[model samples]
Target: MTEPAPLNGFGPLISFILSISALRDWAKLLIIGSFFETCRRLLATVWSSTIDSFFLTASFEDHDDSYKWMMIWLSKQPSWKNVRNVNISTGERYSGNVPDSEGESDTSGMPKVCYLPALSGSYTLWYKYRWMRITRVSEPIPGWGPNHRDSLNISIFTRNHDILNTILQDAKKAYQDAQGSSITVYISDSANCWRELATRRKRPLDSIILDPGIRELVVEDAQDFLASKKWYAERGIPFRRGYLLYGAPGSGKTSLIHSIAGELELDVYIISLSRSGLDDTGLSELISDLPERCIALMEDIDAALHNSLSREDTPTPPNQTAEFIPSSPRTPTHTTSKVSLSGLLNALDGIGAQEGRILFATTNKYSSLDPALCRPGRMDLHVEFKLASRYQADELFKRFYLPSSPKTPADDDQEPKSNPAQSHLNGSICDGGSTDLIDLGVPDDVADSPPSSPSACSEKSERAALTYTGTRHRGHAPKLSSDQLSALAAQFASAIPEREVSMAALQGYLMSQKSRPSEAAREVSAWLQKELATKKAQNETKS
Candidate 1:
């Protein structure tokens, strides 16, 4: 008693289950079905086989060339050439493969396809005469926790492995050539190769607040490094540069590095030592293969060292007295990292190390660093970033406002106020500012550097400094004359006690004032007085 046949058979279910792309490919398959049928019979009669196939699987979770190649190739397939419905998204990418223009080198304005209805399920990827079936899948990886990220599994099957490998390599090369760089970041997940580091575009150098001396030093060194690559080979130098940037967290240490990368037209390779599975071998391999003229940055060197090795195992200098900082609340009871100080030393300039590399190590705990690690050959330059200074405070005010000095007021009524206490009136502190009043802490290179696309904050300032744009503030209000601006800058600088405030704190204060320079100045004055009072009170209480 085989039950009565169902009204609708498996035929209807098959049609319903097949995706549109799959259906289209199936039609093509049927057209060539006879050809394949004839070959199958011939092969079967001769070799007892119908066809050969190579199966390849790719995952979106992978951050390597294999995954990158597959995903890029999939995007170029003709099957989804004319998808009816697509989701597009914009992103900022910094590619290391191409020379960057002056500004926004790390940015991309292109839109990416996020969702393709036609390629949502099964599809066909055809290159040349070779073709393969592609299926999109989302599922958890075996042995991973349930909360782990889902990976998109892309399966490709073809009759020839040669075509698969060749097409993939060619496709990657073409894609990179067409797009220059796609804002990809590479890192080490293990001892094998560098994986992409996921991060947003960084601030330009001009956007950062730094000592002019350091900026010049960095750029000149970069120039020397690039020009001397061949020279180093001609001579017998290692052709490597190492910089140590140590300071408080918000002192623009990292921002300066990003700016330098853009200015030098080089890519940045960041090393995150905290990443699990990284050891001495992996670290050494990473350093030895750093891109030429590229910056190999290891941020928070002290923290990584702490996790990698025990405190007693690390060393300190005998002559330098250590400054005592309160223990961080996040002290870990135990760590599995095997990174050691010696291992780091070996990674930097060991025999296997690559030349034409700009290495930067940043940390707030300068005192904790072993003198051996930062000795002459390892870190050639050690630059300390201090808190806000009088010069910096003046620059901050000028940055928050326009750089041009206000036009000489035709009448006294239009003159900018000179009183620090009354600067906030008329909605802007820079209403009657002047550029000639002070050098404003600007650098020679910054003034001399080509003013292409300026950094967000540096645009107006550069124009004023370089070409004297005399660009107005947000409301198009005229700037103060040089005398007025100089007076205002002096007042602002005087109000800020040198080395007493952090740039981060000063920035926060300025932001709170909105774009009102006068308001920021007044409030900052009151705030400083209160801070001084609070410090005195705390000191008395402690005593």
Candidate 2:
């Protein structure tokens, strides 16, 4: 009964047998191919899972750029606080980038910083529909001992491999942009702790008025030197800049230094030589721990430590020195001052010195400092801040007085006044003569009356009244020309003969008579004469 299928004809039976062999061969090949295909799919799934959970990490070392950027990035995210304990260390930010209810800008008093999450905490951030997991970890490498300096870690997890890099780059860019608004200054309070002393509002670097050559040179050097960090690394040199600003008091040394700091947006860490507890060790520590992109200012250093460097030569400008000698500083007699010359020098160019520091040492006594301290590399550029030149004085005068104009603002009633104070904004002045702006310091109110005879319009008549025009506290800007101020500045500069009058004195004098440009111009000569006389008398007394 089981062998009944063999009843078919022999030809049909042969065909069936061939079909079975062909089907058997095809089935065997399919099974083998399916096995290989399954293996390939399994491998692809494993690789993709490994990559998704690969655990890419970025360890943050204290004071490192990455660590700084991470902290800054954490401070910016609104959702970060919800994930972490962020109630402490909160502060207000004043950048005007925030928006308002009416779609207008309202940037005042925005929250800047809040305490971020501690270690071993995880936060998930979503951006552009892509989710990223951030886990704070401090796993140690097998050989790295416990309490490693770089123990802080920020583990970034994402399915998209490129997301982590993109996040880090965006953070770095944000940190840079945020720092552009102000400059910070750090002062060393303890051996390891540098307390933030001040945060200076940014000033336009162009506002610093110096000799044109000096201004150009300082600006160019600052830009070139800061940008040349890579150049310095290749050459194996510390990326630093040093400038010595020395001259008479009130010559704008300190102001120039501040301007440079503002221009570079670098913090200024002042090492007060006169500070009671400061010694060589303390100073060295301060120098070594200086954060990157900072200016270390040791102002009035010549007077701070009484180093008995040679003072035989008269103080001269850097360019004026026909005979420049790089003298090795002679040791001074041991003084009560805590700092020593050797200690100062070692901290300056020491092997352990911090990189990316700009140093400025200002002194009134240019010849008083030790030569070795002022040598090249340490004091790469020695600039003497002298009294304001006639050109500078003219500029100073215009700067002080030109912004004072606008008695008749466009909204302040179109009606003209009969007096010089309220009426002189337009080219018209209330003078008795021609109804034109008194270009030569003469106001319209007191100008000599139009000639009834030729004798009435005399030069002396108009010039005499010019003396009183600049005395009033008029809100209007001066009608004086640059040429006119230059004339007065030339007179002021010429009286001293030695260019000994400092800008500080000139500024004070001009500020006192700020409302009186004509009076300032005319009286500046007398003031300079008196200043010179007093200085001479003081020198005689000291001698």
Candidate lDDT scores, in order, read 0.61, 0.64
RMSD of each: 16.5, 19.0
Cα deviation of 409, candidate 1, in Å = 32
For each predicted model, how many residue pairs clash, with residues at least 3 apart or on different chains? 16, 3
lDDT of predicted model 2: 0.64
lDDT of 1: 0.61
Candidate 1, residues 358-475, lDDT tens digits: the string is 8888886676677777887689899888777898888776766665455443434444445432222222323333222223345755533333432422443434557552322333
**lDDT for position 393 in model 2:** 75
Task: Report how far residue 173 has shifted in candidate 1, in Å.
Answer: 9.6
TM-score of predicted structure 1:
0.57
